[model samples]
Target: MNPEIIGQYLPLYGEAAILTVELGFLGVLFSAVVGLFCAAVLYLRVPILRQIVWIYIELSRNTPLLIQLFFIYYGLPKVGIRTTPAVCGVAGLTFLGGSYMAEAFRSGLEAVPKIQEESALSLGMTKAQAIRLVILPQAFSVSVPALVANVIFLLKETSVFSAVSLMDLMFTAKNLIGLYYDTTEALFLLVVFYLIILLPVGVLGTVLEKRVRYAGFGS
Candidate 1:
């Protein structure tokens, strides 16, 4: 309703939006790496590590993300491990998103045909070589849609980081509301900024899904 009020906070809102993107990007990257590692361990049936991975997936998937964030930001301080709000927020997102991603990747790895590995073996490749050269590529293709979707979901989930004082978009919006007492304008801006960020990501995901579908594993 008030143009001056909205304009006054636009710069800060922009900064918060940028910070949100940075956190989401970092969170998704770390989570993807951890998820892939966990998936590989479980797929290969690694002795003790597989069980540990399973437990982590189960616990993380079952628990509330808010509690997980609290433990990282609050509980760790009690254990003599102190980190910044950003670090704890990123770590929390990584672990929480990684657990869901692990399942998607594991299913992808399992979907790879056994004969594909056999064919690689027939070519005189070692098991590791076969997996690296033949299986993972196909598995990655199979999992792309799911992985992308999960990343999108995790990006939205970054809002929860506000609880830890990370100045993400949602936090910035709330701060604006507190300062200006203009809930409608602040909330509208919040939705608009999020749409700007997430719309492109969603489109990219759809494009990736179609490309993977049409190209098939051979591509």
Candidate 2:
């Protein structure tokens, strides 16, 4: 490993890593919003809407993200639903993350005490009011760690965005190798980059998990 190669390749890899984080951060933010809404829908047991939410979750969760990305980038545009590569990457990742997160949030909602809802109803709250006030807060409190972990997973999964020309870290690393031809060094740096990005996330998730558990709404 020449320090000279590091000087050249590292900058490209760093840029790539930044792009990767940017893409994932946007996608995860969207997913968190979508997932929470969908989970709330299912939790509230809306007559027809919960079924639709279930279908959405199942379809996205069952399919591989690669195929999802392909369809978004290639398949949809054939029918005129065109978007830029970056937009497509973000959409695909958000859909993908949203599905998985719906399940997590749903599971957390299940852990809430049954009496909580009953008590809310007795207090003359509407279903929406009860859920918004009573259930969701508790559910979200229980699932913070899972949400954080999934965010980290989504962060790593953004590497797939390179295939769509999103120029994320993995894509940047490959480009770096093409320029520098130092496979060992470039690939090694790729691994190190992810470690740097994800380790702190993982540690933070664990700490948050401990806090949630100790706070008594936990598993």
Candidate 3:
């Protein structure tokens, strides 16, 4: 717990934290889109696409992010498809997060009563309009908690970005410890940085969940 050492490496950790956040944000954004699409396919029972989405969801959910990153960053190179570590990190996160998010969204969709859809349609709304305007809003509200949880989980998974040499927060801490043997200080900083990243998210999620529940959208 050397003050001087902590001071010296704080900037490095800050930079790494930004990179981790950037990668995590991108991953979560893309994964949400992928998840929504997959959930829609499954919800609508879209024939061939549903089966493909199911297989993808199973494969992604079953595999580890570490292995996925390894494949994207290392294995892809051998196949003549190269990507930067940052790209690999984002891609891996999206691939893994998508499945979890899909399940969350699908559950949300299913929780909405069938009568709701029927009512929307009986109002002369097109099927797509009913889904887009009526169903999705309620489903999303019901999904707020799970989606927030998935976001936090995916952000934490960014820790493994170091496996691909991405120089993320974990990588910075490990590098500092290896170079200076300041294990205690480095670990302290690591925990602090992670808190800095995740604590606000946790609090925000709670706030959103309460709001959703208060609005009568959550059970």
Candidate 4:
């Protein structure tokens, strides 16, 4: 109801929204890379290293993401390793997102029939060639829906970074509330901002899921 107050705080909200998107975008990109790499390593059934990767994945998946963020932003300094909150937030989110992302990829990889590999081999493709050319593409395609879901979750999870003093949207909203002493407008606007950003994404996810499923890549 306070147009002047809303107008004054609009720039802060916009800047914070951009930063939050940037963090989520970077986190999603790196997490995808990490996820694919880990998925590949597991698919190959590498000795010893596979076990280590499993432990890392399990640890990441089982623990709360907040604890992981705390460890990166708070605990690492105790070991004489230091980093900015931005760096720590991105790293922690990437690590946590990668675990779940890898599982999505792993399911896709396994969904790819073993016979496809055999067929490629029969055509004189090397083992690596078979996997690279025949398996990875189909597997990744089949995983599109799951990947989209993971990305949505990852983006939402970025809100947690505000806990570490990251100037994300939630942090900005909290600051505005402090400044205006108006929790109703501040919090309501915060929800509206998130809805504005996420609603389209949710729609896109649905569209992509249906398209991929119909194309036989998301079965």
List, residue by residue over 88-164, the lDDT tens digit for candidate 2. 99999999999878878988898788888899999999977888888877787778877987898899888888788
Order of the predicted models by lDDT, top scorer first = 3, 1, 4, 2
Best by lDDT: 3
lDDT of 3: 0.93
lDDT of 4 by residue, 27-142 (tens): 98999998988898899898888898899899999998899999998899999999898898889889899988888899899989888899999999999999998888788777
For candidate 3, give the lDDT of residue 61: 91
Q: What C-alpha lDDT does candidate 1 achieve relative to the native structure?
A: 0.89
On a 0 to 100 scale, what is the lDDT of residue 43 in model 3?
98
CA lDDT, every prediction? 0.89, 0.85, 0.93, 0.86
Instruction: Show where candidate 1 strays beyond 4 Å.
Output: 214-219
Error of 1 at 173 (Å): 1.0
Give the distance in Å from residue 143's predicted Cα in candidate 3 to where it truly belongs: 0.9
What is the Cα-based lDDT of residue 46 in candidate 1? 95
How well does candidate 4 score on lDDT at residue 102? Answer: 89
The number of clashing residue pairs in model 4 is 0
